[model samples]
Each structure stands twice: as C-alpha cells, then as structure tokens.
Target: MAYLNKLRLFIRKPFSGLCDFNRATTAQCRKPLPIWLRRDIPPAGKIKRVKGILAELNLQTVCVSARCPNLPECFSKGTATFMIMGDSCTRACKFCAIKKGKPAPLRADEPQAVAQAAQRLGLSHVVITSVTRDDLPLGGAEHFAKTIRAVQNQLPHATIEVLTPDFQGNLDAIKTVIQAKPDVFNHNVETVPRLYPSVRPGANYARSLAVLSYTKDFAEKAGKRIIIKSGLMLGLGERRKEVLSVMRDLRSVGCDVLTIGQYLAPSPNHHPIVNFVEPEEFEQYHQEGLKMGFLAVASGPIGVKLRQHCHCYGQTAP
Candidate 1:
C-alpha cells in the first residue's frame, strides 16, 4: 500500500523532481527514531477516563489537537493543557498539527468548562493555551483572561500558567492577560528568526520577541513577579549559533524559563525534519542555559513540552 502511494505521488510529479522527492522520503523513512524518542503507551483505561471527562465537558486540549506524543502519558496522570478559543487556529504555521481555518464564534461558556474540568481532575498546576484568533479585535486576550479567572475561582490554590500567542504585538492585549496575574506566562518563539518566513509565516520574529519583552516589563511594573517563559524547537534546519542567538534574545527579555526540544514533523506535508538532534546536544544546551542564568531549562528529545516543565523555574527560583 505504501509503495502504491509512492508510485502515485511519482506519477503526479515531473519525472526529474519525482526521483529526488522519492529518494528524500525513502531516506527519511529508513532512518529509525532515536532511542530517547521511543515510548511505551500508557494504560488505555486511564487515558480513556481522561478523554471521557473532556468529552463530557466539550473541552479541547492541545494534547489531542496537536497530536502530542506525550498525550497518553500525560492523560494517564490526569492532566492536560486546555486549548481555549476553540480548536481551529487562524494562523497556518507549517509545522503545527492543529487544524487551521475559519474558527467558530468564541464560546462564553468555555472558561467555566475549563475551570470545571481542572477542578474535577484536581489539578494543582493548570496550563491554559489557545488557538490564534486573529479575527478578534483583541486577539482573544479577554477570553484568556476570563479563563484564568474562572480557573482561579474554582481552584484558588492551583497555580495558573498561560501559553499565549503574540496577539500581533498588541501591548494592550498582552497587558490584559498579564493583569490577570497568572503565576507563569509562556509564549513560544517556536523557531529561529531565519526560519520564520518558511516555518512560521504568519508570525514575525521581532514581534514575538517584543511580545515577550513587553509581557515581562508590564508584569514587573505591576509589582507582579510573574515568570516569563518561551520555547524553541530544534531540528528545523536551524544552526547551533542561531539557536544560541535565540536564547540570548530570550534572556535579554528576562525570560525566566526556556524549553528546547527536537521538532517532529506532524506529517510529510509539514516542514520536513532536517535533523534528529542528539540527547548530548540537548544536554549541552541545558547546561549552557543554566550557565547563561536561565532560572530553569528543559531540553531533551521527549517529554519536553512546555506544560511538562511549567513548574521547573519555580523549583529553581528563590
């Protein structure tokens, strides 16, 4: 069946380009995943229970939407990163697995639904994220703030973390989320600046950095010691120097935590993986980040999702 599919693809393209494309795909398939990337699927019962609960509440999770490899493990533990503002994203990033198109109208009940789900799961640390809603005037910042407040109302003791979009560099929108007083604020830069045109076409590198800088500044001026976090994915054809430069850029903005992980292309149609960065390379970045004064760094092949390391800086912070 796979061979037939390849043959069909070959027939659809010019013969000269077909050979090169087939060779690249074949080579990619031949290369086995690194040992560190392998996983043992967790018990289905626990995963099913978590999914059933989410289904009952009509809550969407980036875990399920993004096809995260860590889903089963995280679900078995009864935790999820709630994806608010609906499942459809406004931006069409090449690497993300989330669906892209016109999204549904913002749901007024989603905030309470997310809060109830977190309380039912008894989550001590809650991570809230959303699809890019560029259509909205404030880019869904108010919705994010409402979700944070709802969760706070239901679980007063739980620490809230929000991974937000750039909001098109709107400082007012950024301030809306910051004023909510989330314990941690995360905005993933996702990749090096050079790759932005191809990797994250809808996003601007400078705008992303500015978003982080403004969030850090606004929160501090408000007398809130909120942790500012950002992340990048390696293996997107980014050079080591570029990766380090991004780290420096984040540090310049007072980013408190950094999450670096190998990029796994969601599909062949997405950005092709240029490399499978080694565990040793990840460790080198981890050590370099610590030396550069990052409060905490999570760098590795797997289990490197931002949510997994939400509390890392807290543990290391004074």
Candidate 2:
C-alpha cells in the first residue's frame, strides 16, 4: 500500500527522479517552503560584483550547479565558494547536478585565477571545492593542493577550506592535500553504507571514512592541527539509525564539525528528494549530534557548508 502511494507521488512529480529508490525507506512528504521563506532570505550585498568576478575568472560555483538554497545569503555577504578541477565530473551520483562528461586538460592558470578572485571579492575566508575528477591520475589532488597554496599566498589572512575529493582513497593523494594545509580540510561522506550503490554509485562509504581518519592522523603526525569537517544530506531515504551510523563513523575519525541539511534534487534527472525535511527534525538531529561529540554542529532547513554558519572547529584538522 505504501509502495502504491509512493508510486503515485512519483507519477505526479515525475521530475522527482526517485524511481531508482525503494519507497519504504523514504520519509513522508512535509509541507513545501512558504513564499515568505523565499522572500526572507538574507541578501547578497552586490550581485553585480559576484557575477562579474565569476565571469572574470571563468569559474563555476557549486552554489550555481547544485542549486544551493544558501547562495543568495552567502553571496550577499561577499563570500563565494569556488569549484575547481573543471565543471565536468567523473562520478554520476543521483543527488548532484554538476555535469558529467569527459574532462578537459587542466588549465595551468586556474589556481592563480581562483586566488585572485578570492582577493577581488575581499573574502576573509574562502571555501574551495571541485567535482570528482577520476580521469586524472592523482584524482586532481595536486591541483587541489596548488589552489590552496596559491590562495594562501595571495591572502595570508584568508581562512581557506578545501572540500576535496577522496582521490579514490589514495593515501598519497590525501597526504598531498594535507601537506598543503588548508585551515579546514573537508570531505563529505555523502551517505550511509547501504545507500552507496543507489545514491553515491561511484563513491565508497568506507573509503571516505578512512580518508577523514587518515587526514587527521597525518596532520597529527606533522603536528599541524587541521579541523576535519563532513556533511550529509537528509531526505534521501535514510533511516534515523543510518544517519546515526554515519555520525559515528565521522566521530571515529574525530571530525570536528558536521553539517546536516535537507537534500533538494537539482532537476528532473537528478535523485528525487524522499521528503522535505522539517526544521524541527533538523533541530532534533543537531541536538543529538552534540551528544555524539561534534564540536560545532549546523543542522537546520537552511544549513550549508560554505556560509558563515558552516565554519567548523576541531582538534588536529586546525
């Protein structure tokens, strides 16, 4: 009977793209966002400058590609998280909207351009991330490190965070990123172990945990505190225990900060949101995570990894 109901919802919202999932695990639909919710977003001070800098650097933001709800608020603050390694992605996760295609050769100049953009925007803290680039031998680890170095050199005062790929679990690549030493080192273990094939088909659940643990271990060995952070999206058909399991995994690696946000499918072709998570539920999880040992926790209807609220604090992942 529940299956029939979910099927009906799927048919009515054909663009929801959850056909690939089993209905039983998903949550029931919640109320939609109010019109006022859209209108009340914190403003991005000057969009002209935001658009102009993006055009100048010829760069793309996960804000635009993933259709983040937080874009307006973050850009209004004169801060933007830049996506590196080209717009093309090697992995085809159901939740992501970044383009998937054969990647182009790396441009030798992107590192400097991103740094210059951060400087131009006068960003005191910048978030840098990229689509997974499996085609590259080191999984684009060198590029991630280089970009961090360039940004730091240009703005010594800027607090830089690199939301890096797992580099297919290559310890060396992980080391390379840690060596560059961004203020915050982040890798999203996007979902639970069971959902790997369905939601994150190209990513490994365990490898991600290992990467986080190893990153901290390496940093500790070098005596450089690097705060390790990770995020997960709700409304992806995961159970409460499953989410809790992920939290435990992250804690095992001593992840300092955590983000739990509602996952909204980008388009009809993307993974359908199993439900629209309610603000109260997010609050519940936030409170529970504090019990579980996350130093800084952000979980709400509006949580994201690139905003003022997204900054994290931890032990070695300084």
Give me the candidate number with maximum TM-score: 1
Q: Which residue ranges in model 2 land beyond 4 Å of their true spot?
A: 1-31, 34-45, 303-318
lDDT of 2 by residue, 90-129 (tens): 9888877678899888889999999999999987767888
For model 2, state the Cα shift of residue 201 in Å: 0.3
Model 1 alpha-carbon drift over 4 Å, by segment: 1-31, 304-318
Return the lDDT, model 1, position 59: 93
Candidate 1 lDDT over 120-169, as tens digits, reads 99887788989999999889999999999999999997778898989999
Q: lDDT per model, in order?
A: 0.78, 0.72
What would you estimate as the lDDT of candidate 1?
A: 0.78
Clashing residue pair totals per candidate (backbone < 3 A): 0, 9
TM per model? Answer: 0.87, 0.84
